[model samples]
Target: MSVMIILIIVSLFVASGFLVAFIWAVKSGQFDDASTPSYRMLWDDATTQKKINKQSSNHKQKSNGN
Candidate 1:
């Protein structure tokens, strides 16, 4: 019974620490550029088929010892 109380207190303290850290991160601008990541993900054009084809050709040359 007493161990349960100690466990609850420790759990609450750990949870509070996490909450404080998250709040500190928010205040420190960690989540400032929310839209940038989303837009960057969508705007990235480097994944086009042309680039992949070139990479594949390079790998093929390496495999052929050329």
Candidate 2:
């Protein structure tokens, strides 16, 4: 039937849209770090905090000198 043909065409278009979206996501690095993010929460941030504190202290010393 004509209705069936139309439905098939619409379904194909929808499927193709999803495929294109998936391809675009892959090409744009959407899945580049699948493993890192899962373990990111377990990583220690103490070093980062130390660096930030040191920078702030240096800034304060400069301001006091000026």
Question: How does each model score on lDDT?
Answer: 0.90, 0.91
CA-RMSD of model 1: 5.0
Worst lDDT run of 10 residues, candidate 1, spans: 41-50
Could you say which candidate leads in TM-score?
A: 1
Off by over 4 Å in 2: 44-66
Model 1, TM vs. native: 0.61
For model 2, residues 1-66, the per-residue Cα lDDT tens digits are 999999999999999999999999999999998999767765547667888999999999999999
RMSD of each: 5.0, 4.4
lDDT of 1 by residue, 8-65 (tens): 9999999999999999999999999888987776556655666888999999999999
Model 2, residue 49: C-alpha shift (Å): 13
Q: Which residue segments of model 1 deviate by more than 4 Å?
A: 46-66
Distance from true position, residue 32, model 1, in Å? Answer: 1.4
Number of the top lDDT candidate: 2
TM-score of each: 0.61, 0.58
lDDT of 1 at 2: 100
